[model samples]
Target: MSEPLLEVKDLNIHFFTDEGVVKAADGVDLIIERGKTLCLVGESGCGKSVTSRSFLNIIPSPGKIVSGQMLYRQQLPDGTTTTIDLAALDPKGKDIRRIRGKEISMIFQEPMTSLSMMHTVGDQITETIRLHENVSKQEARDRAIEMLRLVGIPKPARLIDEYPFRLSGGMRQRTMIAMALCCNPTMLIADEPTTALDVTTQAQILDLMLELQQRYNMALLFITHDLGVVAEIADEVAVMYLGKIVERADVDTIFNAPKHPYTQALLHSIPKIAMKREELDPIKGMIPNPYRRPSGCAFHPRCSQVMERCKHITPNVTAIQPDHTVRCLLYEDMPEQVTQKEAMHHD
Candidate 1:
């Protein structure tokens, strides 16, 4: 396989509160290849949003990155492989700012908050370009319009001058995508970019992303809880629970041969277009509170196939196939003693 464009290794992000440090993103490791979409999928509050936010260093002040690294592999001017570690850089450092938009960019879940009401849409996009590149105002304007056109915004020249509020819901999303791609960054991190948009708009946004991804050949880390979104555009999928990644596989393997019970339940919860409303299935139980997360396997309480050991021991990620990985006792190569104990329960 080609070297990953971005590698997140054992990443952990926590938030300090009067109660305690809440682990929002923990031990997340995944790879994003160039020109591919690798989505983080799970229910709300399962750390899907946190993981993507962590990439852009947008986690609020109370939050702390306890450990782990975000590594970006790039070719140096000398044609050597150079890995820049994002987590290691200080927040105020120039390196982080230079990379934030030029090498890595993020589209927030809410466009209104990210977009400035004071500035015209054209100015907003150009402002980002001006921040990162030493380009003339006219050049930035042209580049901004080009980005808008690339994202399928209609009549880019006219639309670019309008304020965020002037655009429709779907148009606002497209504007966000336009701003995110302004720099042609090596990686794009989108956190629930389609939320609140109607179904038809959602489909259009996903199609636009795929088209832009192919045109730029940049790696995409799509953070979402929607399995329908995953089915639409993900080349690979990562299942996150609490703050840890539980299962990761190609879309086909995940949808067909999920090893983690939690992943299976998540897939089962997706209402198929062909299924009637009366026959729809939803996963039982709510996402456990992060502060009061269960010991051992986080999903054990909700996992129907949970073994006794699951409640007491956190299973290490095991590879079922080269393309599939899961963290669950069921896939562990337990010794005869442990295997026999589990087998007895199964029998």
Candidate 2:
């Protein structure tokens, strides 16, 4: 197997607020290879977005990565490979800045607020290109126009000069993609990029992103709450709850034979065409507040297959199949004493 482009291990990020510390991300482990897409799926406030933002050290104020190792394999100009621990790098220092746009770029959830309304889209794109590359102004502008065209913007020459406000949601998103890919980064972190678009536009954006990923041979960290999108675009899927990944497996296994109760609930929640009249089986209970996260398993409160130990002890992440892993007591082998205790408790 080829070396992974990026690997995150035991990542923990938190936000210190007046209320309390919010554990936005807890022990997230993920891997993304070149030209492959790893979809991070979870409900709102489940740390999917936070995990992606950590890649570029762009987590908003009051939030900080408490512990983790983000190993990034970078190919230098001389064609030599070096692995750097991104978590240890200074967030706003020169080294990270050099890598952020050139080696890895991100498309945030909302393009309207992400793009500056004061500047022409053309200027923004070209400025990003020039920031990482030592290119002349005209050359940068030409490259920006080419990127706009590449992203399927009509009349790229005219559109480039228009401000972001003038474009529709889809158009703005396309412009964002154009800006992100202009540098030909090795990895792209797209956080719910299609959330605000209509279904048709969402499909178009997904298709466009997939096409661009292939063209550039870049790895993708796609964060979304949409299972349908995961089924359509993801080679691997990681199901998260609260903060930790509850399950990790191939896309087909995730959809067809999910092992974690949380994963099962999420899959069951998806509306089905064959069962048109049936109501969606929404997961019971809400995701617990981060400040007062539930004891033991963070997801025990909502997990349908909760066990006695789930409320008292955290289950270690265990591998069931070759590439599939789950953090649930159901998969663990219980000692005879513990089994007898559980049986007596039930009686």
Candidate 3:
């Protein structure tokens, strides 16, 4: 129960279009502890990526954060500490720039698009190092080689001059990891860094990330739709649907005693090894259209446990225990203390 490294409170991001404002993320809250991983899990287009992107102020055009507080406990070089509200800072201001790559870094989902095809792998890594650190070219190049070696690249000296296209998928992902870690940031936000790789390669990349996380004692915010991966790497889990976080708990509780219907459905949907492919039970409905979001509880339309009230009144986030919370009417009568936020309960 140590102080969290970062806390996101009531985050709301929207995409303004000719049609209407798409609520990509609505009142999403999350906490990341030092040296631990918090996996943001949900179906595709559930606002996981949008919420994480806002951490670095990289929300794409037409999408803007309308409200929220991203409180970060930053440790300065002089053995002092300061709390900064990242949401209020100008996206292109000096404060955010200093924090972006130096204290907080992101590993984008696709390295192919994230990396500059024009530059060699060595050049990309060195550019990151020099961006946040004052160093000579030779010094930066040497650091880049060391990083490549650390990420398990072979013959780093020679590969330093090769382009990213020359590397295999796994190698390219490892290179991306190298570039992200070269600055030794205090936290790393990885947005589905393994979604594009094969199963075997996926496991390797996961292990590499976990190993690096421990080596640097860095907090990690891992965004993915893979429950299996969450079971492997996450210390805590947050289940998101249609921009709202419906469940938050430790990984074990999330798997063993899930509270939210969306969470239960997601777990049931995971393909089990013993079950036949045709026997799998997937969640019934697709994510609703953002512009036409359902009334009251956004999930009621697909929820098996939905009640009459759920179709008319939004459910408040109810805390069932110290380490667990659920946004569902079923838990409102629980004897345990309920930390209710009436203000955030809305359609």
How well does each candidate superpose onto the true structure, as a TM-score?
A: 0.93, 0.95, 0.95
Candidate 1's error at 73, in angstroms? 1.2
Residues 1-347 of candidate 3: C-alpha lDDT, one tens digit per residue: 78789999999999999999999999999999999999999988889988998988989989999999999999988977799999999999999998897789888779885688899998888888898999998999999999999989999999999999888989999999898899998999999999999999999889999999999999999998888899989999999999999999999999999999999999999998889988898999888988999887899999999876677667789998888999998887633222223323532
Residue 145 of candidate 3: its Cα lDDT?
Answer: 96
Least lDDT summed over 10 consecutive residues: which range in candidate 1? 338-347
**Which ranges of candidate 3 are over 4 A from the true structure?**
334-347
C-alpha local distance difference test of each model: 0.85, 0.90, 0.90
Which tens-of-lDDT digit does each residue in 1-347 have in candidate 2? 68899999999999999999998888888889999999999899988888888999889989999999999999977998999999999998999999897799999889965699999999999999999999999999999999999998999999999999999999999999999999999999999999999999999999999999998999999998888899999999999888889899999999889999999999889888877645878889987878898887888888777876777666778998978999898998879687557556644
Tell me each candidate's RMSD, in Å, in order: 3.1, 2.5, 3.4
Model 3, 76: alpha-carbon shift in Å? 0.6
Clashing pairs in 1: none
Provide the lDDT at 240 for model 3.
Answer: 94
Worst 10 residues of 2 by lDDT: 338-347
Candidate 1 lDDT over 181-206, as tens digits, reads: 99888888888889879989988898
